[model samples]
Target: MSGGLIGLSGLIILFVLLIIRIPVAFAMFAVGFAGIWVLRDLNSAMSLLASESFTIASSAELVVVPLFILMGNVASVTGMSARLYDAAYAIVGQIRGGLALATVLGCAGFAALSGSSVASALTMGKVSMDQMNRFDYDNRLSTGVVAAGGTLGILIPPSTGFVIYAILTQQSIGRLFLAGILPGLLLLSMFMLTVVLLCWLMPGFGPRGPKSTMREKGRKMAGALPVLLVVILTIGGIYGGLFSPVEASAVGAGLVILIGVLEGRLGFARFWEAAKSSIVTSATVMLILISAHLINPFLALTHIPTLIGEYLSALDVAPMVVLGLILLTYLVLGCFLEGFAMLVLTMPIFFPVITQLGMDPIWFGVLVVLTLEMGLISPPVGVNVFVVKSVATDVPLGRIFAGVMPFWIAMLVTLAILVAFPQIALILPNTMIE
Candidate 1:
């Protein structure tokens, strides 16, 4: 039997394991180990495992992942989300569906610090939903905006997804990060625009309140200035080459702690909690990554990625058609899998095909991140949706899902734009690095 077919059988076993509710990391690892043993020998497989683990563990770039995650955990536990939301509300709260708009904006701002979508959604929903409900905003609209907006966590800088993609594809983490900035802001704009449009069309969807005086607006802006500065200093330093991503994360974490202490918001208890959470989260990510390395070499031995790339390249297909299909597949797979697991599993198979077809890796990363956003809000296992439901249990899951539909449409529209004009995701990275 051919090596590829032997590898193909491993894939089948992996899927069966997944369907039986095996953890994704261990399932992939087991299948990969078995595949290597079958194709070569147990000794070679054991050597590969030993060597790959050391290499992945020793990489300098990998430090950025845990550091950034630690920064996020610190910012989250220090009550940064509430402060950002208050600042957002002060700016937009008086407008039609203002609180909803604020929720989206707040999520985007919070996302700058927190790289996890589930964390962002959970934090923002807990802090923002009651205010939205108080404003008499539609349940679906409020829930939808927050859930969709939480996805920006990865779309913006310091994302675990971007780090993983860079590592997997051997791309520069800094460039991958720069590539996402404009697209992230662009999506943020589109999200805000969608809220406005919805309010304009269906006035009852979001009710307008008394406009704030200039003085009040100024105070709100000032209240949020510290966070804005943190974002600018950390993200700005990384993009501007003043600090490496890892150093930038350290700076960010320090700044968050400083701000929290100055404001008397981050006591020892909160700091300890954040530290413990960061350690646990970092351990989990490292485990998944180790598992990915195991599966990756096995998949490479199959040369299936090459075969898939050749098949895709040979097809009489428009790149956009293929792009759409890939996205639709993500949308479907999203219903069952969380974003991180899905990316780790599929990128090995799909990214090569897309890259060989002359697609930009940076653009593809944004597209993948955007597509993963849907998975966060999609039914069954939508991480963000489940988060919102957990916080607002009185609200039905159906209503939260229903509310998120418009935002989902907004996300789809943004995806179409990125696909149509690859420049949207590429221009910043290209020029910035030059």
Candidate 2:
């Protein structure tokens, strides 16, 4: 048959494999290699496989993946994440839904350090769940806050999501990092407002927390000062042109380790565990990226992206309408696929359409990452919801999903605001970078 038909069949088989619970990287590798062999030759397929694997595994840009993950893992092992929560609690825990608000702030802070949504959800859930429970907070609100707030990890600086998008689209990672700041904070504020409205409407959902004395607040803030400083240094260093993204990652990791050791928190055994975990996570990301490389060439050979771009360009609608449709597609697919898998699968097909419309790639990257965050909380395959469930095992799965609905709506609102004013995602990157 035609190349397009072969590509179409391969995609269907890939989706079937995913639905049957095959691992994402493996499924993509299988489909991509087989499609290349069918369209070209076995030797070509083998050559592409070996070369792609090596290229992705040794990529210089990807150094950030392991280092940033190690920083987060070490921070968790050393109780730095807990101290961040304590500082946020000291500031806001006395207000109505205060603990939930603190959880959002803590997630934002930790996201700046970790850049992994699973790590953010897992760490914050462990640190905040019992505290919220102690205050008689509703299980739904407590679990929902952790699940939704954790998404900040991908929108803040040092985000793996932005890194991968940059690699695939050939955009500037530093610009994408800067582009995300305002939008991330906007989403954080929307989450906090959602908590306030929920508590106001349903007073039993989140009760007011006990007040902290000024001295206690000061002590807690002081305890978290190291983490705050690390965040400012790493992200600020990137914006100030003092360090490239790779250097920032290394610096951030070194600083976290130094703090952990000096504070007598991270012992050799714990440090070893964190390093090992970072290696495993980094390996997984590398594999996905390698598989994506195979898939991109296979799709290019089929001319599918060209066809889709032509079809989109022929449409009479405004570019914003097309953008809306594209985002809506992401929202639907997110219910079925993991965020990175979705990014790897769709970027090759959709990114060209974005550029053809004369839109800004950096702004689009921020919007795409934000959509991925929504998918982390969306049902059926809400990865963040499952992460929260693993922490709060006694709570029913449906309840956690239900709790995230309000925050999910809040995300939709934030997405809308960014769409209305593209400057929200562009202002920093525009003025700061060039």
Best by TM-score: 2
Stretches of candidate 2 exceeding 4 Å from the true structure: none
TM-score of 2: 0.99
Model 2, residue 311: displacement in angstroms? 0.8
lDDT of 1 by residue, 1-434 (tens): 99888888888888788778787778878988888888889998899889888988898888877667767777778767787888888888888989988888888888888777777888898899898788788888888887888899888887888988888888888888888888888889988998999999999989986688888888878877888899999999988889988788889888888898999988999989988988888777877888888887888899886687677777898887887878888999988876777888788778877877788888898899888887888888777887888888888999989888888888888888888898988888889887
Backbone clash pairs for candidate 2 read none
Cα-based RMSD of the predictions, in order?
Answer: 2.0, 0.8
In order, how many clashes per candidate?
1, 0
The candidate that wins on lDDT is: 2
How does each model score on TM-score?
0.94, 0.99
Question: What tens-digit string does per-residue lDDT give for candidate 2 at 1-434?
Answer: 99999999999999999889898999999999999999999999999999988888888999999999999999999999999999999999999999999999999999999999999999999999999999999999999999999999999888999999999999999999999999999999999999999999999999999999999999999999999999999999999999999999999999999999999998999999999999989988998999999988998899887898889777999999989988999999999998999999999888989999999999999999999999999999999999999999999999999999999999999999999999999999999988
